[model samples]
Target: MNWMDTIENNNSVEPIEFNVVKVDHNISLAEAIQLSVEKSGYEVEFIETFYGIEMDIKIPFLVGTEDDMINVNITRDDYTITIDIDIRRPNTIEEKLDILEYVNDNNGFISFSWNNEEELSLISIWMSRERLDAVDMLLEHRLINIEMGNAYVNDDKELIQEKLAQRGELEVYRDEDLEFNLSGEWNATHGFEYRYILRDINELINAIQEERENILRFT
Candidate 1:
């Protein structure tokens, strides 16, 4: 079954009610993040930070097994609030390549950065209070697939070949429709960086749905 089916069929996991609100410019970023977490029915454990507040939050919808606990780190700069999670650590070159392909295909809701020294891939979603609900949905969908072990690497070569062929056929139109641009350089020493900007919540949700269709088509 696809992700939406999985979400519908599974009743053990409680649905999180995302309290989307316009971010008050007067309030601090830490307070904003904390309020969001609390509204979602999770306790926020604040981690001391020099600039903005850093905290660990557990997203219940993303948890699969008893041992599965997704760690979400929230931080902020002068302008934006950043939510970062370590999605996966690739053990082989093929796995890393698979992740890169996935990132290229579905970068609308999240941007990715790689750590060469640690072999870690970080999935980051930028959010404003107004777009928090959409961001939360996108984040949950991505993490659920990751936990299922099918978001990135596929062991079936035939399926991979079919997906590549399908993608090749749609390349021109997809490029025109999405109008995505790649900016940044990859270095052996410094690793890689990729970022994408979404204008609004509709754009983000569309990206997530398109990505889901891609996965379902292959499977």
Candidate 2:
């Protein structure tokens, strides 16, 4: 058909749609990110220039007493986005530092780790600016990714003392026993007696603050 006929018949272009596929954690990182965007309320597309202009953006958060903060950084890499996070805590609280972080890169491999050895536990995550918001907000909900920490357990073993009650030929028939169960299936599944890992509560707030400033530098 002639080009004119194609446009006249609304055939010059066709609607575009994507197929939904299901699979395990083996998809490419790009595809994984694209899926997140598509699943979200946002649409993914390549823009030559935003607003036909180029500028810098920055964000800031408070770091009070090192016990209140969080830092999120999103940077662009080629066509992908890198997410970086820094979870900070007060040195006073580090006396009991026990944490575990889980993260997923793209969908499978491609992740890192960081040990909070400054006696002031800190967690960090880094990625592209595009996925910054998704990741930053994700911090609240948590996204399984590179983790370098430990979570305390009831490992605080406590002695279990119990007295048994028994009656034999002397009286009648009644018996009782007692025991203690710890470090078993109950505390192994991720969340059973595992708390937030920090007693400061506000410590993460500060680490994220610095991260916000870092991310804002990109916006």
Q: Which prediction has the highest lDDT against the true structure? A: 1
lDDT of each: 0.36, 0.25
lDDT of 1 by residue, 1-219 (tens): 422232332334333433433442434333444565577676656554554334454553332222222233333211233434344455677756765675566443244333444665454434332112222233345632433555332122332233334444334323454211111111111110011111222233333333333332222
lDDT of candidate model 1 versus the reference: 0.36
Point out where model 2 deviates above 4 Å.
1-39, 43-80, 92-108, 114-122, 126-219
Q: Using Cα atoms with residue i matched to residue i, what is each candidate's TM-score against the true structure?
A: 0.38, 0.19
Model 2, range 158-215, lDDT digits (tens) per residue? 1000001111211210121100001121211122111111111122332343334332
Candidate 2: what lDDT?
0.25
